[model samples]
Target: MSSLDGTVAAPLSPPRPSSRLPRASDQDGSYPRPQMLRGAWADLDGTWSFRNTGDDPAWRTGFPDARDIVVPFPPESPASGIDEPGFHPVVWYARTITRAELDAAGYGGAAPRLLLHFGAVDHRARVWVDGQFIGEHEGGHTPFTLDVTEALGTDPDTAHTLVVRAEDDPHDVTQPRGKQDWHEHPHAIWYRRTTGIWQTVWLEAVPTASIAGLRWTNVDHATMRLTVRLSGERPAGARVRITARWHEGDEDLATVEAVVPVHAHEVEVVVPVARQQNGQAEDELVWSPETPRLVDAVVSLLPAEGPEPLDAVSSYFGVRTVGVDGGAFLLNGRAYDVRSVLNQGYWPESHLAAPSRQALRREVELIKELGFTAARNHQKIEDPRFLYWADRLGLLVWGEAPGAYAFSPLAVQRLVREWMDAVERDASHPSIVTWVPANESWGVQHVATDPAQQAYARSLADVTRALDPTRPVISNDGWEHTNSDIVTVHDYEGDGARLATTYADDAARTALLGGRGPADRRILVGGAVDEGQPVMLTEFGGVDFQPGAKREDGWGYTSAVDDDDWVARITALYDGVRASAFLAGSCWTQLTDTVQETNGLLNADRTPKVPIERIRAAVTGR
Candidate 1:
């Protein structure tokens, strides 16, 4: 799969779907990626035959004539050849998959399991391999894997067609759709809707009894707890051997062991990689915004005495702990000091999908260069590419969610499922120190409007804690309070100090009413008094954005200021924050401008807008 770094090949819109089912005109044809070719699977992102025609029987076999439908990007993109308005309820795409080399590699050799992986498919999707139903999946942002082994069909396989049918309600409010405007074009808070297959589609072959899943926790320097789940039809009395390799400098440490169990589900095994280096197992150095060192390893599963092992996937880990002590956040067992920003992970070209892997890396680069160690990835859940980059770059991230506005039990279930998957997939990364659910009490507010937003929020926190107690969870981050580990809040214009201290209880406030400074029932610290909690100053410097006409006054995303005045405003805000003892570390509203909101230190194109040296000097108090 081509990593999203830069230089998008543009995008093409798929044919708009009609609510009707199979159409005669379009049944024989679809996108070209469906063709069973020599390379197994080709990049289906370039220009393709496209036609919005309702249906034609000719499509069932092949297209008679068509426009282009870019893979991985929905129809309505400006880059897409067909950028017309209107949402499609259903869309169809057809591609063939056939690997003559792969088919020969297996069968005669042994049992081969061919798996098809879809990085992401918007809404509901159904796949038919060789005209036979293969499988289906639901979810726009995450990934799904289906086994095409059964549908590959028999002997000396000839090239075959694989058709995929998808139905997406870009306007559907039920799914975990993010920031997509249901009616018409996008504005603030909402943007263009992405429909259909918007990510990669690839295939891999695995032997029977292969390693299905892996979970690892970095306990410390020497010892790490690993859970392995093996899959495939196996011999009842089969034995699988597992081995690990850790390479550090000139010294290479390896571990080999055999497991003889009745069945293979999830077995925990411990390995001491750090102890080899003469350090306490628990002393495994931690990775954070400051020191982002990573340890890489390979997990191999083999049969009895076979070296060609069943499966081996490359993985990496970082050493760090995340938690809360006395209502104060801590990283690496110490009271954590944070100066963070909000990262939405958006680009002008791909929208939510990053332009490339290098593009994803650039995100961490910008976050670190901005003089901040951490950032709150607001709403839109990020791609795995982002987490991988964060782990390598040592950028502290607060894994946020794509909050739902409406409260539905189904939606809640999906939220927990998708978020739990995100946690599981990226948990090994040291940069994700925390998980924040229900930002500003969107669904939490309506779900549990009674006294505390705790029920929904706290339940998620408890779940997160149960999964990984090492990290803290900020349930319902905002004015809405919950009995969470950290009392996180976001204040636009008010007593920043008093709000920060509430967690420590050094200062308490009765309430705030859209005003700043001292008020009745004052509990805000920095009121020239004590009795406030150990304030964090989670948010403060939003003082930067471009100012236009009153019609274009959307500074709420970030403080609207002329691009020329951004440096001055940013510097002044940093100075003001450092001057106040009540403010520990303040995460400015943003690190880069996204969409129409231009408040980032860097523009949307990842170009630096201010002098880096000056910003660094201001941050270090030079």
Candidate 2:
């Protein structure tokens, strides 16, 4: 067959065996969706037939070239085997799913329906199974699924060809691109682009009537709320059963079942914690960076009269709450000094895609070892697997959305849709303590003056709260805030005494409250006034220091002469931040040194530029 672009379609070749197979056990931390786990699933992270289609739409039906690329890694990354730095707006991927693979994933077992899940695909993606169009999705940073059972036909022995088409315009500034650069070359804060398939792709088998989604809400210290959404057939008199247990023990802490009405597709039930029933202190069961306790849960769908569940999935959550009280950032109703580091979530080898699942777990451990309780995932909707590690390992996270450079109606629509999806996808994770929708006025550039931009900024915060009100929403993270739950400022001043004087006492409060602050931008906009929101120095202390490298080779807010100088500079910065009596929390500029940004506490390869102990002490001031 010949493609419409005057090119003969190449014969589909067998998928090359991937050296990086999915981890065998969920306990080993290879499961892509950590919060929700099903026994019957197959990892699709492997080799695939790849082709750069450029701007040609003709390649959607068939590709004319034969190439190989690794799944879940963008082509711009060295790990993908096609480390092309230049822009290729359109790309295609193809792989064959054999009957053996399907059978191993339980396709003909208890669960018959087959669901193909993509953890994330950049910009836009369209899926086809055996030449039949299955579905399409937009927004690069969130997951989407397609039921391909019918597309694969009823034959259990049949093999199916799965194809994906991704379109990511590098010059399209209206999209929520985050730190992905629009130019051909990386510069300043922006790095290389992640065009397509930067996260996991997997397959799962489920019954016709199955659990589609699960959400856990910490209703109170003593109560937890579970919301279940069903898929396919919603039989009348169906029931959803929920059983929650402590992570360590086999004893069921709470069990609750709710009946689904004839037409109801969703149901919510409250599960009471037994440990906190008798006026016991909520500390034992509550989740925090110190304790890091988790409650594992199994959600099942049952017919009105059946002894067997139609479908089941395992999940986990923590009983915790985050809020701002006066000048304190409260966690579980108690004041907590948030020590956070800005994590860009990029790797030298894999770009936005993590090098491996184990790397994600180590990232969390490294953050904790550095003495920071929280990580602000700056300008990226991180992989859910990373959030799983954070949930298990007890590191707080601030969920943020990628920002668009240009502001337009399309930009507003794209950003809102993606940001909402990001929140809804991660809302169940216990690690996420805050939602940052905009940073430094990236999309809403005129928010400080323009009424429309201000409304947009306010709406982002408002809509995020509407979805998940448990976490505080920073409307604009850095500056030019409107309707923000926390008043956050971004200042890179290096001098310790000067930084202290700038943020001290009533003078700083007056300046910040009156729409003036360190960044020389308005702290409040759209006539919004500070309503006693907890003020935090959210961004500061970007001291560039790369051992055995020239200072001019990399960039940061400030430069350090050597390792000792780096320690002294960071310690002074922390001291200055601590000097501010009204500050509720602080987040340093970065966790790792990115490609050209060498101001990280650790090097890009997860190596500490200075001793880990010194970095911890500087970060914690202890």
lDDT of 2 by residue, 1-622 (tens): 2211112233222112111222111246788787777776788888998988454555545566758999889999899999998997888998888887797677876678899999999989999988888999999999999998888777778788888999999999999999999989889889999989999888988888888888888777677788888888787777776544463454444333333332478788677665565545567678899988887666667777753567767777888888888778899889999999999999989999999998999999999999999999999999888888888889999999999988898999999999988988999998999999999999888888898888888888999999998889999998888888899999999998889987888677877679577768988888888788899899999999979948565989999988889999999999999999788889998999998899999999999997899999887888
Model 1 per-residue lDDT tens digits across residues 124-171: 788776766778887676677787778766654566565666677665
Q: What are the per-model C-alpha RMSD values against the true structure?
A: 11.0, 9.7
Q: lDDT value for candidate 2? A: 0.83
Could you estimate the TM-score for every candidate?
0.79, 0.93
Q: After superposition, how far is residue 473 of candidate 2 from its true place, in Å?
A: 0.9
By lDDT, the best candidate is 2
Off-target runs (Cα >4 Å) in candidate 1 are 1-66, 79-86, 98-111, 155-157, 220-222, 237-242, 245-262, 273-284, 305-308, 451-454, 494-505, 508-539, 547-564, 579-585, 617-622
Error of 1 at 185 (Å): 1.8
